[model samples]
Target: MKLGFIGTGKITAAVVQGLCTSGIDGLSIAVSPRNEATSSFLAQHFSNVRRMHSNQQVLDHADIVCIAVRPDQAAHVLSQLRFREDHIVVSFVSFLTCHELVRAVAPARQSCRAIPLPSVIHHTCPIPVFPAIGPVMDLFSTIGQPVTVDNETQLHALWTLTGLISPFYDLLGSLSDWTVSHGVRPDTASQFTADLFQSLAHAARQSDPIAFDALAHHAATPNGMNEQAAHEILASGAHQAYRQACDRLVQRFPILDE
Candidate 1:
């Protein structure tokens, strides 16, 4: 299968890198010239990857077309390209609804919206795709766990959770700084912080049936440091603040009704 990407940004780079190393056979990946560094890097490093001079060149040769442009640039970029009925259009534009994508890529009967994070580069992360397309699902699953949702509203809700990634990093950074202030070496503190969460995340993934609250409670003993910290954080409304932030982000991406 031939794959084409319209915007060669971070997410595009990650997905391309994932696919190139995913062991998927007979795949030729073409990327836009928008991000020269990323495009050149992929083309130079991957034998199956090519850097296209223009967006149209990608569409002209690819069976599957991926739209990864910025939200603001989506209209102008997509308006210039023409899609065929056989093209499978997958959009990574967070704010672009399925309705808008169908209109933008008219005559392309197949289209879906997807959210892939940087973890995709490491073949780790949840890829939430709306209105599941078989080939697309197969492709994403090779790199990450793909969750298919038929409802656009629910898909938008999942996308809202992806927004928490930055806040998650901030929490890790703050904890690392706390450790560093206590005389720990910078590299040691950073490694500990990352490894600690990685182990926790791995446990969560392995124990699929376990409730998150149960795990949280399991980590805290009565009158323990974990319990005290959890109590203080709850008292400060930190969890509620995170929920409010998610609500605000959900409002930013509205899905149109059919």
Candidate 2:
């Protein structure tokens, strides 16, 4: 399998790192030289990966080309590149629908839209893909749980959820700070706070039906501390605020009228 990436940003770097360490045979990668530091780092660390002088060079180097450029640069960047009919392009640019991307990468009959988290470096994360392109799906499955959606609306909803990464970290940071204020060591506080959430998530994943309310109810016994915390968080409308924030973010990806 051969892969090339047009942009060497964080997500691209993560994907490259994961794929290189994934132990897949006959795999080679080429990355554009736009982000010299990242491209250099990958080339230096991975034997199968190399840096290309231009986006066109990257495209020519691999059968599958991934676009990781910023949303603002997507149109301009792709407009300048030439694609082959056999090429399969996967785009990481937000708000660029598969249709728009297909037009941008014309001559390329196969295209996919995807956004993977940095956790992919560990070969474990949710990778949301659209249209269920088989090769793209198979490739992502090697590194993460590839969840394919039938419609763009659901894809947009999933992308909106990605915005919560920072807020989720803040929640953990706040809890760690609270413990530090009580005289706990900073390292111990951070580790305990992170482990608490990770364990909770793992437990929730084990639930057969995976009902959040059911899990919350189980954790929050009659007038227990867990119940107190849940009550305060929900009663303050923090949960609803997350929904509203998602609503706002989803608006950023308007339905592209055909």
Candidate 3:
């Protein structure tokens, strides 16, 4: 199958690298020259990937097109390209609705919204794809865990959760810093914190039937350090503050899917 990407940014590079190394056969990729460095890097690194001279050229050569352009640039960029009636479009551009994309990529009857995290480079992230058409589903499934939601509202809510990634890394950094201050080497502390969180995440993923609250309870024995820290954090209202932030973000979403 031929896959083309209209923008060559980090997300695009990650998806391309994942797909190229995915062992999914008969896949060739066309990338736009919008970002020359990234496009050139992919074409040079992956034998099956090709760098196109233009965005229209990407659409012209591939059956399925993925748009990874910024939200602010989407309307302007899409206005210049033409899509075919048979083309299937998957947009990685946030804040752009399926309705808007359908109009922009008119005649390309099918389209979907997707949010892929940087972890997709490792082919292990949860890629939430709205509408979940078969061809797009297959693409996401190859690179990451494909999450199909009922509507765009649900998809947007999931995307909002992605905003927490930085906060998560910050938490890890804080832990690593504390360890370093307490005499551990910087690299040792960083590695320990990263591996610790990774193991916790792995355990959470493995515990499919377990609710997060239940998992937390299981890890926290009475008067134990985990319980003590959990109590203090709850008392500090940090979790409530995070929820409030998420509510504010959802309110700011431009797409009126509600």
Candidates' C-alpha lDDT? 0.93, 0.93, 0.92
- Clashing pairs for model 1 are none
Best-fitting candidate, scored by TM-score = 2
lDDT of 3 by residue, 1-258 (tens): 999999999999999999998999999999999699999999999999999998999999999999999989999999999899999999998889888989999989889989988888899999999889899998889889999899888988999898888888998999899999999999999999999999988898888785899989999999999999999999999999889989988876675645
Q: For each candidate, C-alpha RMSD in Å?
A: 1.2, 1.0, 1.1
Residue 52 miss distance in model 3 (angstroms)? 0.7
Order of quality (lDDT): 1, 2, 3
Residues 57-80 of candidate 1: C-alpha lDDT, one tens digit per residue: 999889999999999999999999
lDDT measured at residue 32 in model 1 versus the true structure, 0 to 100: 95
Candidate 3 error regions (>4 Å)? 255-258
Over all chains combined, what TM-score does candidate 3 have?
Answer: 0.97
TM-score of each model, in listed order: 0.97, 0.98, 0.97
Predicted candidate 2 versus true structure: per-residue lDDT over 179-235, tens digit per residue? 999999999999999998999999998889999989988889898999999989999
Q: Which runs of model 1 end up more than 4 angstroms from their true locations?
A: none
Better by TM-score, candidate 2 or 1:
2
The weakest ten consecutive residues by lDDT in model 3 span 249-258
